[model samples]
Target: MRVMVASLAAVLLASPALAADPVQGRWITEEKDAVITIAPCGAKLCGRLSKFLVAPPQGIDQRDVNNKDASKRSRKLLGMPVLTGFVENGDEWRGTIYDPKSGKTYRSILQRKGSNQLTVKGCLGPFCQTQTWRKAG
Candidate 1:
């Protein structure tokens, strides 16, 4: 049983449990446009556009026509991952955020403020735009 116990301990130390991160949940965007669900994808954390609270110009079932890649243009917007490669950085998260409207991806910094608020920063060079997202009910 000693070897079995050692193996179990090693496995636990290797992979982080998803539930340990408080950011793993649904959040309302700063604009209240859509609900984003932040969850574990592969070995990292990713945030996806899960639900639309407001309809866009093309409606809820719209395709990703604004994507830079022609092949990905036909993909649907809902359930699309806007935040990818997010990993724990001290108390915050560092990741890449994709903007469907601009067809661009930016360096993103996610810092949780208080219990219900999260500050998301999308950076370009030294300039960054910040937005506050609230935990969804």
Candidate 2:
């Protein structure tokens, strides 16, 4: 009985770590405009734009000209860390998401759907927009 109890305790203690974070991979945004790679950053998870599938809009700077911080305005959009400060919340993750298009930051939640789909939500007050992303090869 003692051995069985100890084995059960060990398994329960190790299960969370054994279940890897499903967001730790490349994902194609719902708009199919870009791919972002999610990975561990310190104790939290963050995502960065890794590739652009479509050509950037013409007649506009390819830089982060709309960023609130003037110094960051010159930074390139590609390879930018748009998702940050995410912490695990049960099966989902809560964080902040940056929209370079609008140069705004909003409360975000990311949840995995099956093994290949991820739902990304950004909320401003009672208004929230959801985008579903697919696993990228």
Candidate 3:
């Protein structure tokens, strides 16, 4: 009886640690255009731009800019943080996403849709857009 009780206690204690840190890896957007690697940043999680499968899509223009600074034109946004301040919530994580193209930040949430898929949503009040991301090898 004592051995059974101790074994059960150990299992219960280990469950949370085994829950899996879903965001602890690299994820690629469904478009397969870019990949972001997420890892522990202090006590929170942060995502850094890992790769650009190709040049930024044509016809896409920068949104917020003074249009006068020469240095801005030379900025390399490939390794910028697209996700930050994310806290684990069950199978999902909630945080803020910065869009370097627009120079804007939005409230974002990421939820695991599968073993290797995540649904990312960025919103301003009631308006929102969702994109699917897959775990990258």
Candidate 4:
């Protein structure tokens, strides 16, 4: 009885950790426009822009001049933190996402669509937009 009870307690305690899938790696957007890399940040998971497959065309304005420090920055938007504090929910993840293009952050959710595909959703209340991402090679 003692061994059985101990084993049950151990399993219960480790359940959370065991349920979490390792999502640390690089993912690319379906359009091949952006790449995101996920890694551990403290006890939570965070993701940042790792690469840009194509640069904004010349004469195209891509700066958000509305943010507090927007005027102090350049047009470069690479390496920005797009996802943060995402907690795993089965095969999906929920958290906050920052969009450099709009200089805004929104509630976000990410799901593994398949072995090499991911779907990311950013929402504000009922309005939501989803984007597909592929595992980076």
Candidate 5:
């Protein structure tokens, strides 16, 4: 029926630009300390800390004591969302990245380089730090 055809078309047409986003995957941080997985979340893409390669000083079962929000301080860091509110912007995705160590949030931009590397930039106004993340194995 036309209704069935329209529904199928709606789903297909709704799936646009982001369907082939190469940056949507797991990546190892520059320090090789953790693995973050990037995936679609709502209207934008978000990355979450999926695994810890090295245990924190507080051990593997660490709580987010450094979190600025008192209510969230007791939360666990594993599976915590590090990158959020990211939306496609040309060759890069701009968003916010949270540093669990510092308990601060910074503006972040992400771009994929080649097939195995991703450039992550965290910015504080005019100054920015860059790190290259490798594809997670």
Candidate 6:
């Protein structure tokens, strides 16, 4: 029926663009220190620290104590969002990455390296660093 066909078309059109991108999943940092889970935050992609391979020196309750924003310094490391505001841009995702260790935020980009890898880059003007993160199990 026409009604059924129109309903199907509407559902397809309403799907998110991320359906074609495999960025939603768990990934381990290059250093194997932390695991970040990437998922949809409204219409944008965001990553949060799900676990730490190496225990924090300050213990499990470790806080973002170094954050210059005094109000945010007390935030716990676990479940803290590190990558946010990401929007798909062709082959890469453009966004900002927060470095909890340095308490700084940098303009960042995430490029799919392979089926199970991603190259994350953070830039501050002309300075930039790239890390290859493996898709976690």
Global lDDT of each candidate: 0.90, 0.89, 0.76, 0.77, 0.92, 0.91
Better structure of 1 and 3 per TM-score: 1
Alpha carbon lDDT of residue 15, candidate 2? 80
The model with the greatest lDDT is: 5
- Give per-model TM-scores: 0.83, 0.82, 0.70, 0.71, 0.83, 0.83
lDDT tens readout by residue for model 3, 57-127: 54223222422455564545567677999998765788998776566678998887767988889999999
List where candidate 6 sits over 4 angstroms from the true fold: 1-20
Evaluated against the true structure, the overall lDDT of model 5 is 0.92
CA shift of 48, model 4, Å:
1.0
- Residue 6 Cα positional deviation in candidate 4, in Å, after optimal superposition: 17
Q: Which ranking of candidates, highest TM-score first?
A: 6, 5, 1, 2, 4, 3
Worst 10 residues of 1 by lDDT: 16-25
Worst 10 residues of 5 by lDDT: 14-23
lDDT measured at residue 33 in model 5 versus the true structure, 0 to 100: 97
Model 6 lDDT per residue over 1-137, tens place: 99999999999999866523557899999999899999999999999999999888898789998788999999998999999999988778999999998999999999887789988999999999999999998
Model 3 gets an lDDT of: 0.76
Model 2: lDDT of residue 46: 96
Predicted candidate 4 versus true structure: per-residue lDDT over 9-124, tens digit per residue: 99999786534446678999767987899887888889987777776553234443434475634644566577999988766788898876567789998887667877889999
- Against the true structure, candidate 6 has what lDDT? 0.91
* Model 4, residue pairs in steric clash: none
Q: Cα miss at 62, model 5 (Å)?
A: 0.8
Residue pairs that clash (backbone atoms under 3 angstroms), model 2: none
Looking at model 5, residue 107 earns an lDDT score of 99
For 40-117, candidate 2 gives per-residue lDDT tens digits of 999999999888887677422378888999999988888899999998887789999999989999999999888899
Candidate 1 deviant stretches above 4 angstroms: 1-21
Question: Candidate 4 at 36: error in angstroms?
Answer: 0.7
